[model samples]
Target: MLSRCSMLPSSSDVQSLQGLSGIRHLAESRRFKAWFLDQFGVLHDGKQPYPGAISTLEKLASNGAKMVIISNSSRRASTTMEKMKHLGFDPSLFVGTITSGELTYQYLKRRDDAWFAALGTSCIHMTWSDRGAISLEGLGLKVVENVVEAEFILAHGTEALGQASGSVRPMKLEDLEQILEQCAAKRIPMVVANPDFVTVEARALRIMPGTLASQYEKLGGEVKWMGKPGKIIYEAAMKMADADASDSIAVGDSLHHDIKGANAVGIQSAFITCGIHASELGLDSFAEVADISRVVALASKYSSCPSYVLPAFTW
Candidate 1:
């Protein structure tokens, strides 16, 4: 483990970077080599690719840069790959991809004991609205849409909860309580595939998998979060990359998840400030707009400083 002090660069060190002008030149210089791009904000918002996203990717891909798509998405890797192609990203551009769901399944199935030995005889999965995208049952895991039908339950965020149902969505606090009651009585454990509280949708905020997981815990149900900010996920990412902590770069938007995850492994990071709360940027001299360095300095105070910062993925 890297000592906290060793990972931090003092204010003078940051001042030496020469700011946005230097960043632009560095990006344009074609020296950074490879890119590990995220899906939600950097490339697409659900079904639509953000403007300039395609061209920006094309620019990077054309320059002989190796690209990897790393996401905390609940969708299986194949489904995410299809979405990438649909969003105008050439599938050929990326060499490898990893998702939280894949990691969750692998983590469970490979344990010395059969997965979910603690959860009784059977397990049920409660996935997001994109149900057809993944099938845990193939691995001998049972799948159920409702928690009442489950001996054990696993949940990611619900898309329907954010849309037409709005507050009426089934993952509400009351419904969660009912599920927790059932599980507690039966003594079942819940595994949460993605544990982020909220993710940015362009400028708007939407619920993430962690919200449900945390709620489950409050009800005295055992809940395990399976993604970044959680050690398992970052370790899995490093294993996939076959990378040493000092040789990798983790580019993400959330300070709590992305920045902290990378820092935990001694991997460097590039923070994306456009996501979550941009209003706070103005408080830091519009650091959100000009460059990523300010965000790095700001994170340093909180013990989660990133190695570098970048705007949301734009050319």
Candidate 2:
């Protein structure tokens, strides 16, 4: 694997996790020239930037860090950047933004890959109704009303589907059983743009598009994942930053998404404990530290590991 710790024997389990209180030490070290950051949990909670997130980005920028946002969000990169700006983060802090939606759109437009080449144009587009708007406007794909007419399925979010059906709360997997079964029976292929089961929205866990993708897989339907945990997005991010895997560090809150993605791509990674796994790690408060063994066990559960552990993305 390409990393600073390449001397260590290649193994599934990480040798050790270096603990840190904030990003200041990494900033001072000037180790990684390229930074790949997650959006929802690490930078902001969808409404506002994290306590020290803005300043941390500013500090990294000042230190000549080439930062790129590597988010699993279904919205396009430009849309995600606009949201970051609305959340009080300076848009100039990032060199580029790579999101699942942008990748999905590009694939559909180019029809370059084998999976994308065989697909028909008619699709069932699943996206948010209340927020996080996405569009298939330029892809030449038709959005059909029923599964019978759909040549493929585009899953971006499920929370908004619930909202559209008169429910405002997060949805359970069983809620989509009828629809998924129909698609499965027809052998329809689904493209999941965001591969996160859940995400932090104002400190509350809400169902994401990945959960629906998992359910579809269980029903024997084909699924194409577009975001993190998939190697292509990371490779695209590195290419955009003009960085090599050995010189990049990914900072994110989701283990299965960010950490595992970095691990697959041979890049160093830091895990922020304040995001999705905070409760699982028994963190009573944000300041509550997670025991090393517990952290190791939890990472193992996700079949992933982190190179460094931090309480948050603080300065």
Candidate 3:
């Protein structure tokens, strides 16, 4: 366990890379009035809850902490709630959730902005039907089979290629190169709802839509990002939480997504070292503490900083 600090920072506005033992320490400090949490790495690793994660959340809720889930998940908020409930987390504990998929669906349905209004309805949808697909049925968007017939690309999920022989079909990054080349040639714009390059999936990492969106950009295709590190999503989460920027803290594992987003929003951030960047931090287990210098170096490499660092999310 990390040595408990004698005292946590008195203000959430202070940006310090302090080491923290658990969520209980932060809760006791009462520095942050509300919490904006990331769903994947900070909460569960897809299949099961991280050690002490459920209890930590329960304790925070019982203490009346206003918490909101701000996720880069391509699944809608309701779908997220279903998974949370299945994992034995009480969804009511959170003020609400803001997911990239929910934002994408809203944008497509409302077409409230100039960029969305200019986009045509025909799109080649890359998705994961293996683990609950994100349906675009009500968006009034037509789903075309390929780039030739599509006007745009809505990337919700690209890792699963649908089931084959009763097994979940796996897709390679190279597999999408051909399709990406086609879209680039036709100048079809792509909307990446989730801007996380990869997500933790049961002790392993799975490629997310963000990686493909980045690749499409390299291929000269126009890409629109919608998730973490984006100011809008952060604002949406804060809106749901009714949190003041100075009184909130964002807890997440990804430096680029969570830390960078918090930096953009001018809030406190807690970095979980045991998540996606575990190997880079030289951690072999969740309980293994990360070298503070290396943790700082990693934060610099990602161009973001955390106000507090923890080996794992616990209480």
Candidate 4:
């Protein structure tokens, strides 16, 4: 049975979370020795780093905080690192990065586990044209153009791909539905490289791999989710951080991903309300303080309350 903590907050209960403060204030109060930070909403708006994110990460690093980025981005760790550098984040500030793409690559590379070993060599890749088949390259897996020829499906979300291709329009849901139908009819198991349903990009939301995976599952197809809100990615991050879950804290904007994943791994969580859910909760920006009552109510509604709540990630 699913725990109440895993339940999502209702739209009507969408409100500000209480205990909003700066990152430094919460760190001092919670005494977390390690940090697992989210990328899209917490550190950047998908295009650039949030105002104080770089400085704050630098300060935390200087203070000897062990940090690892736990992101649901479909990009591999090396690719994510390069993107971070381009967006002005120093690689030295964090110990390591654990992305869904990297995890998927590792799984395919190892192929030791039963599920992975059972996955046939031919796959239908639903990835960005620019990203190409880099993640699956060197794995000896054949990329097929059609679902009928595929033994499995590899999804990397459509919105990001469209953006990477420089298209102003978003991929339509109907197109995705058709693809899901074809895969489901063929009984193809899908591997969702990024398990985020939607992510915010400069105040606009885009569908992610998790959305497609969920839809496929609902349509009677199997899905292998590769990132947060799941335990596998958190375990990988924990190993990279070299810290126990008890002493670690996960900081992210999405309660569904960060908070739920941390709870599953016995780590405390700090929700950054200003990131993804800010506007829906009626907040101006990451800089604004949220109403305490509304925040508490929101937590109660989701049942996945964070140990701490911050207006934004700052020191």
TM-scores for the candidates: 0.76, 0.90, 0.90, 0.87
Candidate 4 lDDT, 265-311, residue by residue in tens: 77778788787778766898666777656665666655565766678
lDDT tens per residue, model 1, 1-315 = 462434565544332232333333435653455455567755666657766667766766676555667778776678789878877778877767777777676666765555555554345444455433244544555554454656677665544222211122334545555655666676568777777777766556677767777777776778877777666666665666566565455667676777777767666566666555354454232223644456555666555765555555555
Q: Candidate 3 versus the native: TM-score?
A: 0.90
As for candidate 1, its clashing pairs are: none
Quick one: ranking by TM-score, best first?
2, 3, 4, 1
lDDT of the structure predicted as candidate 4: 0.77
Error of 4 at 166 (Å): 18
Count of residue pairs whose backbone atoms collide, per candidate: 0, 0, 0, 3
Q: Is candidate 2 or candidate 4 better by lDDT?
A: 2
Q: Which of the two candidates, 1 or 3, achieves a greater lDDT against the reference?
A: 3
Flag regions of model 2 displaced more than 4 Å.
2-21, 160-175
lDDT digits (tens) for residues 177-259 of candidate 3: 67788889999999988899999999899888999998999999999899898988988987888877877889999999998
lDDT values, one for every candidate: 0.60, 0.81, 0.80, 0.77
lDDT rank order: 2, 3, 4, 1
- Give lDDT tens digits, candidate 2, residues 1-315: 754333322234443333433587776774688999998888888878878788888988998899999999998899989888877888888999999988998999999999999999987766675664466667887776578888988888774332223333443446555678889999999999989999988889988889889989998999999999899999998999999988899999898999888888999888888888989988865534577677777877787778877878877
